[model samples]
Target chain A: MAFSLLHGVHVPHRKNTRDMAAVRMDAPKTVVIPMSMHIGAPAKPVVKVGDTVKVGTLIAEAGGFVSAPIHASVSGKVTKITDYLLSNGTTVPAVVIESDGEMTPDETIAPPVVDSRDTLLEAIKRSGVVGLGGAGFPTHVKFSVDLGRIEYLVVNCAECEPYVTSDTRTMLDRVDDMKTALVAMKTHFGIRNIVVGIESNKKAAIKSMMGLMNEVVATGECTFTVKVLPSVYPQGGEKVLIYHTVGRVVPVGKLPIDVGCIAVNCTTLAAIGAYLKTGMPLVEKCVTVDGGCVKEPGNVIVPVGTAMSEVFEFCGGLTEAPDKVIYGGPMMGITVPDTSAPILKNTNAILALSKKETKLPKTTPCIRCGRCLNTCPFGLSPAAIARAYDKRDTVALDKLGVQACMECGCCSFVCPANRPLVQTNKLAKVLLKEEKAKEDAKA
Target chain B: MNTQLKLSVSPHIHSGRSTRRIMLDVLIALLPATAAGAVIFGLRSLLVVAVTVAACVGFEALFSLIAKKPIPVGDLSAAVTGLLLALNLPANIPLWQCVVGSLFAIVVVKGLFGGLGANPVNPAITARVFMLVAFATLTKAAFPTIVDTASSATPLAAEKATSLTDLLLGLHGGAIGETCAAALLLGGVYLLVRRVITWHVPVAFIGTVFLTSFIMEGMDATAALAAILSGGLLIGAIFMATDYVTSPATPWGKIIFGLGASLITFLIRYFGSYPEGVSFAILFMNILTPYISSWTRRRIFGMGGSKA
Candidate 1:
């Protein structure tokens, strides 16, 4: 029931672009915006082929309360509407647009009036903002927590993953927008405590926020503090951040709201503030473009749906042929299928790693070093979960709490034998789900 | 989709510490002990160590080839086993007998049980026990004929054990590596520094022996100190009992194992026929590692339980 703040692995903070402010890139020839960028339902396409659309125009509507709408990041004509393949290999309907190169904003774009909590959440839903830290969960759903249940609002800017600094840029560059969101939330939610969680390694971002901390709290009676956490990987995880900030464990199979907290990504909050002020929806993203193979690496403010290859090219392209192009940090990033896959709304960084960085050694037998379990942030025994998975013993897997694994890859990262521990944990969770499904059917 | 782009799982990076690197560290850590053994037991000790190492690696390679598996001699784990087994044996033992012991360790105990990291008990420790029982020369030479030695028998085997000073400096007759307490301690420090092993098992194992022996011998601290310095207690406690594959993985499990091993060792040393019980104690605890590990698992976050 208690949190071990000392848990989690110490990873290299390869913040190569920490000093580089994001540059806005020119619109490419075309863009392929996917409909299913958020966690829940895929947005239904409202535009057909040959339909003219402008920047900030809603091309797709939210499928459900949990889903987020899709907006045009660049003024263009609807070139095609077809199923597109995501990096995870899932096929979802996407809207393809041919950019006119003018980068024109939609004429109808205007800030919505948010006089109450419901309207604030409604404005957030209309903004199409998701967890821009790469989780892709709709931000409005998290914002719409029960008023009394949410006690602390945590701005998670930890950016604990290696080589990602978009959140750092948000803190350093978008102070006004972030403060606006904070003041808005304080007015509407009436939350007493506000904690800004960031790694200690990010001193610049820490200082940047520290200089302006009083601005948000000055409007109302609030306890706002910048909690500088240890620079450990997965410290930015919602559960870990919530625990480290509020010192409360969001119980197993529960949400942060259940623990009197709501942790949102700093960039996600910035986007909501920008949306409220300028009336433009979530269109552009500031992405950290760096890895071992990149020729020149920095942050780039690219429109959503721009092909990753174009983004990489704009960042000076690769020095060598990248053997693995991941869409996030090396610790928990998913490798893109190719350079052509369009960057999604939640994408914070694009890494092009050479063989030296991506090539894994031959996996030897488990030496039982306990490093996997020892370094696990949640204290889960990945080695035991691995055994239970091998035996298909669902009871053992459940008892080991396989579902608690957040797949931060800390276990796999520290494995001396190079075992795919987090990968096995993911599979074991799936197997446990299947077994439980069978039991439910029988019952 | 580009085939050149790897679609591997998450965690595209590694710590780069391999099993080979770990085994290499173990070999490096054993260097000081080997030198001390050679100095104390004479030139014959180095020969026995070299022959046993060669024999173990040879047997592992030969068995792997025969089993149609890739030869794993490059990992140097077999070399580590050979050195550990050599240290446990008498320095004056025949080189051919060393080969036999190495074969039992690398092929029979290790290879037959699914090779490295898969054996239920430590191959080197198990093979030492095996050779002790199977060969009468090992038992007969508990008291060596060498006149230059301080005593006819080892400090523990003799009725009048050597003084703490003699035992600490290893100025007595015993197994090649086990006699030199100073050397073994130096090697243990190296291993601890390199993080090849943790302080949990070594500290607990030696602490339990010291505490229990001090209590059992009417609070005689001198007698307890001699007990650890003599025989294979230092080498066994620091090296063999901390084997990652055979020992419990969790910290609490390791401590439990150390305590359990200490109990068995005291039972054997005080009442049983064997004058030294470190090897047997470690081997007994090795078999119980799986159970200890299951009982002392790190508590999962948000789960309702203690230990499990």
Candidate 2:
């Protein structure tokens, strides 16, 4: 079937570990699991300091319906419950566990009994599954939406971020588990159509997914389709993937389910599959650890809460002191303040970049080239929006649709003048929010 | 562990294409034409280009210093303006007049109006127009002698017996760079390939001129072809009319700007007194850029239907 091409920038796909199998690392000496890995409310710590816990132990429970629970990633005693600094510069409560050197499984760890939709969602929530595609939205909350409205279940295998191939590794290493999860979704959730959107760059992953689809077809399951998307940056974006595969636009401020679709990350599905089989919650993650500064770079399966410094050491420590270490893909990744931050549930890649790679380009005046306009996936006039923002014109900002910017960094990346368009877009959004709050208070 | 890590926004990487780099590309693309102009009009043509460029850069730096703005001479935008302004002038025109034109362009037309991207008109075209008005007798009477043949009038003014080959090869009497159609085309192609400029404005502008001249002259193909090849049409369309700051940013806006410039050019060439109308037409259209840009704002992706 012909799928419409979605708009996105053609970024360099530095999938250095596309062919490298992920090697599992033993738990670090200490694990610092943050209480707020997922969006919405932060999880509240239930385990106290010095309390003994094992892998898959519930260390923190969901603080709200939109939040996901946190699990003990190491067999250890809780060292401390302390405030941890996130990459975004906010402090969150984190439980630090000192490894006991004997990896033990929790006594309650066993295969989940899934007979109905409620049981499946409960099992998913219990497993602490979230969107492993970087946004970290709670997975059970996504599935809890009206299942009848979701017509297409899009498996986002299009790991289009540069220097990140963890999803590709998951698709190659966990094909059977992915198929099992898909079949479960088909039979239980009543999702009729399943679309696996993989970028053409990942030929091995696409081939493996297609093989799974054939096996599923033999069983006479729901219609399974593998949509090959162009290798464009942000092709894995929820809205872009939906538009390309299902030919539907999730209008501004609407969820994917609003367009009769539910998009799940490829690794997220693999996690769900693994949980259904082994009852192991999100304890470890397959992270692609490769960047310019590293001596040896490849994908490694790291336990959650492992310090980034430990991950870098496992990858043969930096050749030179890195100027920046980014979490997730280079395009939309957040630069961590330091390597002391622990890997979260959604952390896909930890890039240790050299000075040359991280040095900010000198900004010049905008030449009014309109390349930013042409490159923005959401069709925002970044140049005009920057002007409106600088002038503090709230009405112009509203009319220009500054709030619709996805902050994918395409505009800033492509600007020849090196104008900080994405930075200005972010500021514009904040300004608009502040103005709106003031108006609301007045009203 | 002691190394400090930089913390900024999301995009930690850039394409590294700077304003200086973009200006350098424009300069590189203009090399063939500048070389051709020098070769065709003798070593004096090179002196004209050099003086104008130096004068323009000096004026820009002086004005920037006086105005307390950052000296942006390194970006090579002033050099581009100087080269363009020099190319539009007669080879035998006085060097002092060239300096005056450069000063007018950089100081009044550009620097006074917030500099560079904030200017409302193309600096080179506005400067050319200024010189044409201020030094009318000198500019009109200073046409270069073509290969020792003393032809007083340019090919456009002569209007009767000039060969198309001479026009294409730029062997006839004209301004320094405007005479070489082949060289200008090569440079234009380079700019297009480098993505420094798009083909929309140049194609539409040249196409409109070709079509309008053909219709105006009652299907005279030679007249229409000569009209395009002669005067400053090629240089203006390829270089000045497509100035990133002065021209519209949207594709539709560029097309409209091109068409409007071509129509005015045709009107001035056929009905008005000037033999060459490229400078005035482009300057007039540059003034309407904001309006054209607003009217032709691209229909944003996934925003209602594909309509303005």
Q: What lDDT score is found at residue B292 in candidate 2? A: 90
Total clashes in model 1, counting residue pairs 3 or more apart in sequence or in different chains: 0
In model 2, what is the error at residue B155, expressed in angstroms? 2.2
Clashing pairs for predicted structure model 2, backbone only: none
* Model 2 lDDT per residue over B1-308, tens place: 53677777788777777788888888888888888888887789899999999999999999999999999898889999999888888778889999999999999999999997899999999988888889964346334444656643577776556677877888777788888899999999999998889999999999999999898878999988988998899999999999989989888899999999999999998888988899999999999998998787655544564221
Off by over 4 Å in 1: A1-3, B1-3, B140-147, B150-153, B159-165, B305-308
Instruction: State the TM-score for model 2.
Output: 0.97
**What level of docking quality does candidate 2 show?**
medium
Q: Considering summed lDDT, which 10 consecutive residues are worst modelled in model 2 chain A?
A: A1-10
DockQ of 2: 0.57
Q: Which ten residues in a row have the lowest lDDT in candidate 2 chain B?
A: B299-308
User: Where does candidate 2 stray beyond 4 Å?
Assistant: A1-6, B137-152, B302-308
Interface RMSD of 2: 2.7
